[model samples]
Target chain A: MTVEAFLPRDTTALALDADEVAAALLDAGVQLTRNGSRGAFWLEPLLEVKVNGERIAFGPVTVEDIPGLLDSLAAEPADHPRYLGPVEAIPWLAGQQRLTFQRAGLGDPLCLDTYRSLGGFAGLEQALAMSSRQIVQEVKGSGLRGRGGAAFPAGIKWQTVLDTEADQKYVVCNADEGDSGTFADRLLMEADPYQLIEGMAIAGLAVGATRGYVYLRSEYPLAAEVLVAAIERAREAAYLGQDILGSGRAFDITLRIGAGAYICGEETSLLDSLEGKRGMVRVKPPLPAVEGLFGKPTLVHNVLTLAAASTVLAEGAAGYQELGTGRSRGTLTLQLAGNIRHGGLVEVPFGVTLRQLLEDFGGGSLSGRPIRAVQVGGPLGAYLPESQWDMPMDYEAFAEIGAMLGHGGVVVFDDSVDMAQQARFAMEFCALESCGKCTPCRIGSTRGVEVIDRIVNGERRDENLILLEDLCVTMEQGSLCAMGGLTPNPVRSALAYFGEDFG
Target chain B: MSAQPSSKSVIAIIERWKDEPGGLLPLFHDVQAALGYVPPESLSEIAGALNLSRAEVHGVLSFYHDFRTAPAGRHTVQICQAEACQAVGARALAQRATELLGTEFGSTSDDGGVTLEPVYCLGNCACGPSVRVDNRVHGRVDSERLEALLAACRQREEP
Candidate 1:
């Protein structure tokens, strides 16, 4: 364990700060590995040197601080960088109880050896040893909910797929994270692809499935490349192939590139896209579990859901289960995005208040203005006001308050953001992006837009405002999918919270 | 004789995506890439191509809020408005950019140099206020520094 302690403020944001940090660490004499960010940007310039069993992380370092750091450690300016600190002690890194994003921000996401060293495929090994029921039980015990927004039970979905008597069950990992404020999925795919692969493999084992496909957004061409390469590596490693580890059971996965449609992030829409159809929302009744991904019993899971499954399998579900509150179990990777300090994925147990997310890790508003409102979930989620900051981060909790934990996306808005404008944006957004599968979402969205515009233009604003509410109700219940249903979240929540702004 | 482009919505998008599967994403990509926008004409075609009704295509496009139909400028300058970028002043930068360009997001400049788009994130978290011009990402772009990046597109008709 000769890995020296990486002192605080030695490493920070990588790549963009790579040259400066490298040149600085060089001045200090310790070589810095310009690796991928583990989805932790606040700890930029984080330098990692493996000791014995663990990799040490030092960061939030700058080019200017290198001289003092090197001299303080008494290391040659180009020799051993000072033992700054341990990887776990860094406050920003320490704060996050990473579950699904457990492997991200560690090292080169492309390196197979690195992934292997970090207990990546060990879950797959465990899955291979267990029966389908046992594997499902393990995930079920873990109480892990989908990190992708829906917070659906991962194990139950897998179990359903297993119960289905279909010959060709499929595992579809929804990596087309089109949410406005979340990039954790992309980060996971890019930084620790093996985690996702391991998650899918565990899913396949539980579901008795033999095929897996990852529908990644085309917006992430680079993540796609990494996933493609990781898939290849896994295939070569016997992690994915006709026969798994000489066991009769076989599971293989393919990378399906999404054209970057937000609707495809929806499971059924994703299935449609995977099936070579326009990314239209599919009506759910059979759900994807019975009929999904080429009309077979498919286990449609989010990247985070599958990644968490790996964690549960490797560490035992109880270990994760014992962490969080009722209904919401284990750690949640809350992508603390939008106008905030220390912005990145902050994984904590469920039940943490939005206030903590905003005031604590987020460090208040980024614009230094009084925070007006926050849009939880994603573009489709409700805009909660400052008064609602006490709301805990739980599915039931959000649901009770007319909101959602959709995809763990937290988009913040300072006072500079106009609620009227954001409200209008909801209808406008719906008008522009709806799949138009139903008349309610299609026609209502246009009508919603017209209503909002009339209000803004001060034309019969009061009557139009009432009509907008009525329209939202129709869209919410009448629309086929989330597009129309959740579209009014921003508008309604904004109206509810920021009514003055609308006027 | 040069082929006169068909005014039929289904005819045009089908012509583009008939060769491709993964209809929604690939078609959206092709349409956006080729026309620098997802035109409504193609939107109807996207529906027919996927065997979805016209309303379905319209619904899907409108639902997501990311897909656009209008034309983009010669160069697309996408400034990440996500949390990481915002922390480094992307909000102010986006405001300045939109103001400087004299056009809102999704609209091309009259001169056709660049169309500024507000992207969520470019995965360049560390850089903060990252901007992608066409395909090249410029990290840590400040107001003064943006000129140097935007200046490169002055000569090009499109990238």
Candidate 2:
């Protein structure tokens, strides 16, 4: 019998030399299958072997360890130093409620047979029989909000697109995940791409859209390859092209790549980019749901949100609604990044406190230093001090504390962090990335950076701080999009909590 | 340096994507992929084919950071400068890369071996500080590892 060995083909795993490990395993006469990451990145390149119907885990593996590891596996697998028992029993993965990411890392992501056998297209199959209104109602009943930082009710957007009478409607997947600490979108697309395809197809059926577009970022080359291949496979299987799944209903998806713009992640800006124009934020009078994508109603959702739609349909609305806290009724895909010891993806119910996620799940700072600050959400998110760690990660709770759980990216920083510098960097990033469509974002960001520099240099520090706050207010209230409106989150939070850093 | 594809070939690239809706971005990407960077001369051809003005095409091209008007070095190296990478010493890694490369960000090396650029994020934040050499992304990078990567880029130039 051929011994089966599994290794992740994830970008992170590749960075850790999983390909080299695979070559060594193949040379040792083992049958190797490339799988997706388990999101336990600290244990990557985590290698697994199927023995006696159970996959045993061995991790942080290197090519040098392969000989000894294979030898141990042949002799007594339990005796291996790197062995971590069955893959299912790992506390980091087993403890969380994985709704949207249920099938992540199970098998070859592109294998349609494996995907089908593992209950992949069940949601799409179910959606095939339902009416458009029923589908929208089910999503509404599930309390599913937009996972793309806005926290807007996804069902309402779908309802608007469904109700709007347009000759052409578009389903756009906002795969331009430019958030700093977030990799969930990239991980999901790279790992379980079919789920996103199914979700987009379902959205098309619900909104009477015959065509869909995935506006992906150019940075994720691996995801692009996987998605391109997966889309082709899906089209060949009749799961994406016209007459999807033999229901005689027509729907198809086109993958468009963004040219590296952070603002394109915004819905209107994404639409603008998809139009082959400058990725400038459009005015919000006519929402994308009404007139979008070349003057047609468009259903734009984030990668995670679209993926969650599949889960909501498969498990039923009540099944998904039973998991989370008020107004946030599903598992949040929290990405632990930066100076954390156990940096990875954590999908848990919304009520879990930031402290539990940072300590229990992440194991605190990687440098063994005290945790100074944690930036939740993306670049536009607030920097939270330790005092607010106990707050639950619900959208309402975060909003109550002047924070938003934008994209659920949790970036940790150690005690050595300089909040003032971080604050300045936030402004500098805005200045660099602003689309030049609005004044506050275009001009105020430059001014904000300069004012922060003056304050840090002790040139009329008190006066500069006040000026910085005023500039932030102008950017917050006057800016056209979140790119400018939310620039003050990191800046204000850094100042409010770590005032000493400025002086 | 590689020979720049002639203007006729550039028009063919534009012709391939001109009919598709929202085709300018993809046209630009294909042009840049075939030729190391989007040539400024092709702007008129792209605009003419797509029924857009030269300024319109130029505006879209210049708006994005990815579409450069000139050819890059033999190898392109990008270091993540986002907040997550910053927390894990990406700033120092970037500094080290520039020092070792003898080139600043957004410039090609003296030997034409590498072009250094700062990227916002690579979505590989957990294992960062991340660095991308050409198409492949490597994580948990440090000064020593960056030197080795740059050394390999230089080594390819010797032969």
Candidate 3:
């Protein structure tokens, strides 16, 4: 009898001693294989026994528990207390409608054969058969929008790039996954790098661009290493560079490491940084699709957007189009994080209520306290009170409520959290990360912080509150990019939802 | 101006990337990777090679936080103090860390054992308070874990 155990080599999983567990499993004469996460974070150090091509899960496992688990699995795979039966059948996972993330948490991330076996590269293969126009049309048919918080239509961006004529064009993947509580980009890059590579290659094919780049942040050193290695492997396998799969087209990817700056995640700033300049935001009359990246037309997309493009091509527009609600198509890879019990990557289709994700998927707070607030998106996102938990995780739905589904990162906070402090932090973070491209953001953020500080210190709270609101409006209207523009989201939302905390 | 280790190596680094468009960042990265930090002496060399002014080179170098102006300590410890990490008591952890090291954020220890820096987020938000010791990242780092890590760095310090 052959038994195999798979563990996620992702950043979070490694931090939880998955590496130590892997070593321990090896010492016990158990043949182990490392794979991507199954999104079951609570069960991390999660081991899966593949019996007859079906995976049985065991987890939150320590080195001490390994011997007992191996013994029980040897006797009866289903008899172990730690075993959660069929891996896919788990209610938490089975309920999720994974489209873009279908290949995530599977076999070896780097293996070309493992990828092909699990429906990887099918998108590129399918895309290679179609003309650029047909590919763009198919994407348009899918109704997919940017998963990178902007909610811009992916097909429209592609169409514009395709329409534009330039001697040199580029497809740049925004792998600077800097949003707080978000790890989907990091997870995809580490677990399923080929998907991102294929997506970019497909975009290259569609846009008549031969060169590509993945501008990853320096904070994620592991992701950078994994992506760089994967790009090399892809190049060797003829999946990238010169002529791809005998398709008579040429495209290649380069990995550029970002110096620590949150502003660089902005498309124009990213392009500026890519040109080896200071990562400052640029005024945008010439959209990136028209003029970008060394003054050549460029298509800059977040990692998930490109990954989704790969899936849409592979599964056909209709297959992806069938999953999501309203304007939102396909699954949103929601990153469950912070002060949560079952926090991990949960990729579900749009329209799922926060109540469902928080109660059913996240399993409430990690501290076992009542979840008082949730911050959707990043630092720039709103601090939603429990009353808004029933709100759907849709782009338009979130916007309607004066909130956002920015990058689909849901950070839970328990009742013990101070809303005033969180609000102050919003201003402080803006003051720290603002690129100083515009005055409203540069000066207003510092002033906003002081105003909030005055309110916190109980110095004419009513007057200061009004002043802070007015300041937020000025910054929101005047800032060049989302960095300063959205800083007021958390501050204003906190004021609206948790006003008592201010007093 | 004082002399550099060898002008040939700096020229070689410049020559390698001079043909590639927008190659200054990678050039600086290579220089920093080979040497501990971007030495001030190489600024003129880089400026001449890239055909830019000294102020331009200085602007790029100072704009980024990664390119240290001087040599870093043996170990670089970056603790995440962003919102997600802060939710789980990273501020307290950061304060305790500074107290243990007898230095504040962005400062090297008195013994030059460790340089503690505060990063916004390490992208391990799920399991943070996250800390990066050199290139390796660790999550759920409490005061005890931090003390153990700092002690290890102290032990490895050159006598």
Best by TM-score: 2
Writing each residue's lDDT as its tens digit, candidate 1 over A1-503 gives 12232321111242345566666555545644445566556555556655555565545566666666545444432333434355677666787777777667666676778888988788888989999999999988888877777777777887788888976888888888877777778777777888988888889989888888888876666677778888998889888899888887789987777654566777888888787666778887979899887789998888888888888889997788888878988877777766666667788888999998888787876568877788888888998887898978888988998999888878776777777877776777677667768889889988987888788888998898889999999999999988888898888998887888765
TM-score, ranked from best to worst: 2, 3, 1
Model 3 error, position A133 (Å): 0.8
A362 Cα displacement, candidate 1 (Å): 1.8
User: Could you tell me how far off, in angstroms, the CA of residue A271 lies in candidate 3 after the best superposition?
Assistant: 0.2
Chain B TM-score against the true chain B, each candidate = 0.77, 0.94, 0.92
Q: Model 2 scores what on Cα lDDT?
A: 0.92
Worst 10 residues of 3 chain A by lDDT: A36-45
Q: Give the poorly placed runs of model 1, Cα more than 4 Å off.
A: A1-32, A45-87, B1-75, B80-130, B137-142, B153-159
* DockQ score, prediction 3: 0.72
TM-score of each: 0.82, 0.99, 0.97
- How far residue A260's Cα lies from its native spot in candidate 1, in Å, is 2.9
- Which pairs clash inside model 3? A36-A105
Off by over 4 Å in 2: B1-8
Question: Which lDDT value does model 1 have at A19?
Answer: 62
Q: Evaluate model 1: give its lDDT.
A: 0.74
